[model samples]
Target: MAQPMAELADLLTRLGTWTTLYIDGPDGSPAPERDARRTSIRDRMLRAGTPEPDVEVALELLTDDGPPAPSSQTILVRDGTVRSSWTSSTPGRGSGRRS
Candidate 1:
């Protein structure tokens, strides 16, 4: 079983390498080499074992930059178990409330 902190670190490693490319945005066009580098980073993340759900959650948290909503309930995990459940305003939202 993976520790929560380790799981978070693996997820961050994937996000740190993410990139994208756009041709001739409002500002100006980027050189082909820049686009290629962006693509390479994206590819690497895709190849990594990062879950798609985790990626979506990370993007929402980072880009929205808003206060988190309250958690609706608590989760209890038994020893040696691989999964746990909790409730919140949003479905699948774990009840790891922050102080």
Candidate 2:
């Protein structure tokens, strides 16, 4: 908790646009459905001006096996670098920054 907040505060001090993604659990979805969700997220991020490198990194971190245990994950990227990421037990909507 405190560690994540501290990392976020450190990230905020940098001078670059931030791209954040909040992903919900897989919720027992099939593999194909989860793949579709990944594709959708990738497309949306690319359309929203996120760099390809950052998007790839985000996707890699977000991926997991076996339905993912009803958790939410947040990823923060800046200048093609992933500065912070954390997972929570609570569910989160699949959301991303516009730019």
Candidate 3:
């Protein structure tokens, strides 16, 4: 099972507007900007050798572009609670999760 993203999530809502997305590329420095596409995670959480898809997803979400279409968002968590959820793979189970 997946664990709730708590501390980091808190930081996102309470402090910063963006989460650093780790990508496998030339390690990009963390750039703090008003937009979510400001930086990569080379300076903070992750280094090189991470998968590209995960990085892409992080960028898309933080960048406010939404997860790639046809992709079901399983959890929209805030401070360790489920705000909203939907899954193409698993239908009608959103009631089990809650904020």
Best by TM-score: 2
lDDT of 3 by residue, 1-99 (tens): 233568435544764223233222222334543233335342232365434444444434433233333333333433333343332322222455465
lDDT of 1 by residue, 1-99 (tens): 123756535544553323221112112225675456445634554577444543333222221111233312222222222122223344232244333
Candidate 2 CA-lDDT value: 0.77
Model 2 CA lDDT for position 70 = 65
Pairs of colliding residues, candidate 2: none
Scored against the true structure, residue 17 in model 1 reaches a CA lDDT of 29
Q: Which residue pairs overlap in candidate 1's backbone?
A: none
CA error at residue 42 for candidate 3, angstroms: 6.5
lDDT for 32 in candidate 3 is 44
**lDDT tens digits, residue span 1-99, model 2:** 224676678778888688899777557778898888999999999999889988998898875642475677778877777778777775444444232
**What is the C-alpha local distance difference test score of each model?**
0.33, 0.77, 0.37
For residue 65, what is the lDDT in candidate 3?
31
Model 3: residues with Cα > 4 Å off, grouped in runs:
1-32, 35-37, 42-48, 63-99
